[model samples]
Target: MLTTSQILKKVKELEIKSKRLTRHLFTGEYHSAFKGRGMSFKEVREYTAGDDIRFIDWNVSARFNHPFSKLFEEERELTMMLLADISASSLFGTVLARKKDMVTEIGAVLGFSAISNNDKVGSVLFSEDIEKYIPPKKGRDHGLYIVRELLTREGKKKGTDISRALRYLNNTTRQKCIVFVLSDFLDPGFADALRVAGKKHDVIGIKVYDPMDMQLPDAGVLEIEDAESGQVARIDTSDYLVRKAHQDAFFRHSEWCKQVFTRAGCDLLHISTKEDYVKVLQKFFIGRT
Candidate 1:
């Protein structure tokens, strides 16, 4: 646990770093990536050549006996929500940072970027249930609060249920939002809920993991604890079959994440704790642009 002063200091550090990255590295990329995401209907006008047929106003056209079209203006402001997993599994790290630490940094950066663009930013922190929901709001203070919460908050439960968070999100917010789901993705059976949420919002899944989650070191004998279940077991890492099984488990989880996100028509990014997540985020934003 972190002391009050300690948490305050860490929050300030992250806020500064995240603001710098948002200002210099992510400002333009983030803007261009989500530009024109929210569009609002403006007015109806006579159809012109090369107008999108999908936007045609059929009823108005029939009333006037001519083709008409609906015009839309891009919404200048967008809302961003971070669906962060604060599960116990996130505490396990064998490299630069724990999964939860990486998630906090990424979430802070994203919040700063959104606020920089004059957009509203919020978060939904979850363990097995909906822990908290910070409604979308603008300003530096709100962003700072989010960073503080992310840095200090720990899971109150054991496992992760992404569907619960998604359902909560759908029930609470009626507007279309840019949603970022950050997790180790250790749970399954969230496809249906994810698909439903994706249809109404722009959703992205971020998988934060550690090297140990993929493969165990070739130590002779080691005791490992399941963070979620609090179960401990001894295994011989030197055994080839044991290592293979570990790798295979990670592969299965990765594949399931990919399939679920793909089927829901959402984007998914994987970042290792040892890697530079800033570059990965920049590349994703640029690719979207």
Candidate 2:
């Protein structure tokens, strides 16, 4: 557990870092990468040489005996929601930082980016239930508040229930928005909810992981505790078969995650705790463009 002073110090650091990155790295890329809702008809004007003929208002044109083109404006303001997982499994890490730390940092960056682009930012922090919600709002202060919460807020439950989070999001918001589900994705049985959310909103899955979650070191027999259940089990890490089984399970879980995201028609980005997330985000933004 982090002390009050420690959490405050870390929050300040993250705010500074997120602000800098938002300005320099994501200013333009993030704005252009994702589009808002469908364009709204602004007005009708005399048809220009380059205007698309399909948009011509036949009734108006027939009445005036001249072609009229319908003009549309893009919905500039967008709402971005972050569904953050605060499960106990996020506390585990080996060679890198904890999964929770990575999620917090990435979420901060994204929040800042959204506000920088004049988009409304909101979040739902969950651990087997909806823990807290910050309604969509504009401005830098809102982003800072989200960063602070991500740094200091404690989970009420230890287990992960992504389905509950998704269902909550689906029911609460009627507006179409961009949603990012950030988690280690250790939970199962969320595919149906995810599919529903994707159909209604633009959804993205950000999977944060640690190296130890994928492989176990050969350090002889050790007692392992389940972070969510608090159940302990002794395993011989020195045994090749044990390590192999662990690796296989990890791979299978990862593969299933990929398939789930694919079936839901949502974009998935995997980030390791040890890697620089800015580069990963940049690549994703550029790829979308």
Candidate 3:
């Protein structure tokens, strides 16, 4: 548990870091990567030789006996929501940083990016249930406040229930928006909700993981506790078969996550605790461009 002062200090540090990255790294890439909803009809004008025939205004063309093309302008305002998993599993990490820290930093960067693009940003923090909801709003102050909440807010429950979070998001927001769900994705039975959410909104899944979560070192006998269930078990890591079994289980989970996201028609991005997330995010944005 972090003390209030510690939380405040960390929030300030993250705010500074996120602001700098948002300005120097993601500003333009983020804008071009995600466009607003479908273009709205402006006004029809006389069709030029190069005009797309698909956009020709047939009604106007018949009235004037000449082709007229419809004009459209992109919708400028966009809404972005972050669905964060605050389960206890996020507290486990044996690398450069904890999973919780990585998620918080990523959330900050995303919130900053949304605000920079003049998009309204909001979030839902969940752990087996919806824990907190921040309504969509614009401006830097709201982004900062979201960063603070990400740093200080702790989940009451330790288990993960991503389906509940997705359902909640679907019921509450009617507007088409970009939704990012950040987690280690340790939950089950979320595929249906995810598919439904993806049908209406642009959904992306960001999986945050720790290397140790995938494999255990040969450190003789060790006691491992499940972060969500608090179940403890002793295992002999010195046994090669035991280590292999753990690795296999990790790979199975990873494969399942990939399949789930793929079936839901959403993109998946993975970040390890030891890697620099900025590079991963930059690659994703550039790929979209």
Candidate 4:
């Protein structure tokens, strides 16, 4: 556990770095990627030569004896909700940093980016249950608070119940908003809840993982414990069958996740600990454009 001072120092460092990254390719792309509620009328102006005929205000044009057109702008203010999984499994990582650490950094970046675009940000940090819920609000302080919670809040329970988290989100959020679900996705049976949320909001799932999650390293015989369940097992990493089985299980779970998101018409991003998640997110934003 981090001390209060250490946590605050780390949070400050994260905010600096994340804001720098966001100012680069992130914030602008983020703004373009996720659209607003709808276009709103700004004002009526004199119609130009190339103005669309549909936008010409006949009543105003007739009153003024001139061609007038209604101009509008996109309603860009939005709320971005982050559903972060803080389960014990997220603390397991064999390369680079733990899954939790990566999730925190990415979450910070997203939060800062949203606030930069004049959007509100909120979070639901969950383990076996929801640990904390930060209501959506706009401001630098709110973004900082969300990042601090992401770094300092520890899971009281060990397991991951993504379904419960999604249900909570549905119950609390009444209107449409942008929802970003960040997790290692160690738990199953969340397809139904995810589907319902997808119907009302722009849902995106980010599967954060370590290299070991997919393939076990060749370190001979080893004792491994399930981070969530506390079940221990001995396995021979030297055996080809053992390694293949480990990879096969990961593949099956990944497939299920992909299918669920696809069926729900949601977007999914796969990020390994070894990869640069910031770049991946920027690329995704450009792709959306």
Candidate 5:
């Protein structure tokens, strides 16, 4: 737990760093990747050579005896929601910052990006259940508040329930939003809710993990514990078969997660604790462009 002053200082640091990224790194990429809401109907005009025939107003064309087309303008404002997982598993990291820290930084960056572009930003922090819900709001202070919450908030529950979080998001928000779910993704049974949410919103999955999560260090026999379940077991890392099996299982689970996101029509990004996430995020944005 962090003290009030410590939390405030950390929040300020993240706010400044995120703002810098928002200005130089994400400002344009974020805007281009996530367009404004679908075009809104405007006035109708006589059809031009370049206009699509499908949009022709049949009734108006019949009355005027000329082809007419409907025009539309893009809605400027958008809503962005961050769904962060604060489960016990996120507390384990072997290199760099922990998974939770990475998630918080990424969430702050997204919030700053949204607010910088004059969009409403909100968040739902969850573990086994929703821990806190911040209503969508615009302005710098709201963004700062979100950063503070991300830094100080702790998960009360042990396990992760991504399905519950998705269902809550679906029930709470009606309008289309750019939803970003950040987690280690060490949970199960979320595909259905993810698919449903994807149908309504632009869902993106950001999976942050450590190298140790996939491979075990050759430290001979060691005791390993499950962070969420509190189950402890001893594993002989010196044994080649045990290491191979652990690696294989981790790889299999990672692939399965990718498929789930793909089936739900969501974009997925995997970042390791040892890597530079800023570059990864920049690459993702550029790819979207």
Candidate 6:
């Protein structure tokens, strides 16, 4: 647990870092990647030389006895929701930071990027249940609040229930939104809910993981404990077959997750605690463009 002052300092650091990253790297990509609802009619005005003839309002022109052009504006404001998993599994990491910490940083960056693009930023923190939901709102203060919450939040339940989180998001929001689901994806049974949510909204899956989670290091005998469920097991990492099985299991799980998102017609990004997530995110943004 972090003290209030410590938390505040970390929050401030994240704010600065997020804002800087948003301004320098993400603003344009973020703005272009996700589109708003649609164009809306703003007003009617006399047709100009460069105005599109398609926009010429025939009825208005006939009424006013002139060439009137309908002016439309892109409904540029978007709602970006971050569904973050804060389960006990997120606390385990062998690299630079825990999965939870990386998720918080990434969430902060996304929030700041959304706010920079004049979009509403919100978050749903979940474990086995919804830990907290901050309704979508605009402004820097709101983004900061989200960063702080992401930093200090502790899960009430040890396990992950992504389906519950998705269902909550689907029922609560009436409008379509850009939803980023961040998790290590240790749990199962969320494919249906994810597909349903994807059909209605722009869904992106961010799998934050540790390198150790992918494969076991040759450390001879080791004791492993399940973070979500307090189950423990002893295994010989030095055994070739044991290591191969562990690696194969990890690969199967990762492949399964990819298939789930792919079938849902959603994009998924895999990031590890040892790698630069910013680069991964940048690649994703550019790829979308």
Instruction: For residues 1-289, write the lDDT of model 2, one tens digit per residue.
Output: 7888888799889989988998998988898888877699999999999999999999999999999999999888999999999889987887668888899999999998899889999999999989999899999888888988887776889999999999999888989889999998999889999999999999999999898788899999999999999999999999999999999998899899999999999999998899999999999998987
* Model 4 misplaced stretches (Cα beyond 4 Å): none
Q: Report the candidate with higher lDDT, 2 versus 6.
A: 6
Better of 3 and 6 by TM-score: 6
Sequence-dependent TM-score of model 5: 0.89
TM-score head-to-head 2 vs 6, winner: 6
Off by over 4 Å in 6: 59-66
Which stretches of model 2 miss by more than 4 angstroms? 1-4, 41-72
* lDDT tens digits, residue span 205-274, model 1: 9999999999989999999899998899999999999999999999999999999999999999999999
Show how many residue pairs clash in every candidate, following the order shown: 0, 0, 0, 0, 0, 0
**Candidate 5, superposed: residue stretches over 4 Å from native:** 40-73
Model 1 regions lying over 4 Å from their true place: 37-73
Pairs of residues clashing in candidate 6: none
Q: Rate the local accuracy (lDDT) of all candidates.
A: 0.94, 0.91, 0.92, 0.93, 0.93, 0.94
Q: How close is candidate 4 to the true structure, as a TM-score?
A: 0.97
* Model 6: lDDT to the true structure: 0.94
Pick the winner on TM-score between candidates 1 and 6: 6
Model 3 off-target regions past 4 Å?
Answer: 1-3, 40-73
Error of 4 at 222 (Å): 0.5
Sum up the clashes in candidate 6. Answer: 0
Clashing pairs in 5: none
- Candidate 4, 1-289: lDDT as tens digits: 8989999899999999999999987877898899998999999999999999999999999999999999999999899999999999999888899999999999999999999998999999999999999999999999999999999888999999989998999899887889999998988888999999999999999999999999998899999999999999999999999999999999999989999999999999999999999888998999997
